[model samples]
Target: MVQLWKLVLLCGLLAGTSASLLDIRGNDVLRRLISGLERGLDTFDSTIEIIFQNLKTELESRCSDEVVEQQETENFLEQLISRIFQVVSRLTGVRIRNVQVPDITFEATSENSANVSIPITADVTVSLPFLGEIVDLDLNVDLQTTVSIETDTDDPQVVVGECTNNPESISLTVLHSRFGLLNDVVDIGVNLARRVVSSVVEGELCPRFRELLESLDAECVEKLIGESQDTTQQEPEGRR
Candidate 1:
């Protein structure tokens, strides 16, 4: 999942690399970057949905169809729900709507270090299609992460900081759930899902972003440096 979405960061650099640093306007670069990332995210959303659908179908097909009393029997029902949850968590449909990633904000904290923050908002739906949609719920994610840029070398490195789960740093809420017998279970899952998401951001997604951002940032910076050197050579010695 992380590797797939990392391409979104590359889109920003594609445009930035074509121009010199002095010629780059933050507003224009940011606008294009945001638009590019948004399109990448749309693709990300669709691709993941299809992947989940395929996984669910393939896995469920492998299960044995042994007859079990699954109706009102307490033991049977409990076992069934447990199996269902296992299936849902493993192959779940995730749809993200109203994805809002604020302009990448950064400030140079030192000669070769910068602080960067990214805040994202979105409506996410987690579901499993069973006779229609059995496990379904919409969640709101307000997430932010801080990173540092070490620019001492030709290659800029992105050091990811913690994405705190507090209300201020990151927050998730249950927007709604499909009305059904599983609503209570959905509620409990929401609480667990919130923590799971936070962990994913910290352990999985952030590292991927760091890798992608550093690779692209270095490439773009190298291009800009070359451009700057060319510009310097063109200048008269008195101007230096």
Candidate 2:
């Protein structure tokens, strides 16, 4: 009779242990982890704005008549950009200001991947060097980027799987303008250039985004994901 009681207690203990181990959902852990990561890299928009600021400065620099000679000729891309900046800057100075970041949200897309929505707004001022401040634009951009934990190698790290911008979500409203014709021209120019801009932003942002993730404590992410991994190991035992 004592042996029978002992068996009942053992089975109960085993069942309890299995429940405790399997109770944690991988998605739940991932959500919290991604939330933490988002907080850690809250300066994502600011970083993006900095890139644009650099672009503005570069444009202004290249716009000057006494052109700065190319220090690095290896990159043909830079040479092409310098020419574009010179023409645009000489015609009209583009100043980006009043930048704002949006509340980003995340959704678990896969075991180790998430989809994040980011919306940003900025004010763009276009000025003819001689005429001054010809047009002011309110720019709105909405984009989504896929972030994932890459663990194929020894060092598990966060990477940007993909970044996409909603074409319909991009708009440049002429808030105030001195020249209506120039404003229309600028609007058309922006519309035509939007895709190229998005492509450049995505290319520029991914590397910075990866760097932000790398800067954070990767071990914390590993621990959060590891807990789920450990819990899943109990499946065979539970079946028994």
lDDT of 2 at 43: 34
Local accuracy by lDDT, each model: 0.41, 0.47
RMSD of each: 25.5, 28.2
- TM-score, prediction 2: 0.44
Where does candidate 1 stray beyond 4 Å? 1-90, 128-169, 180-183, 216-240
Clashes of 2: 0
Deviation in Å, model 1, residue 133 alpha carbon: 5.1
Q: Write the per-residue lDDT of candidate 1 for residues 76-153, one digit (tens) a residue.
A: 212222232233233333343444443334434443334445455555554432322323334443334444556677
Q: In candidate 2, which residue ranges exceed 4 Å CA deviation?
A: 1-92, 150-157, 165-169, 181-184, 188-203, 214-240
lDDT of 2 by residue, 34-101 (tens): 44334432233334344444544443343245766668423222332333323322222345555565
User: Cα miss at 127, model 1 (Å)?
Assistant: 3.1
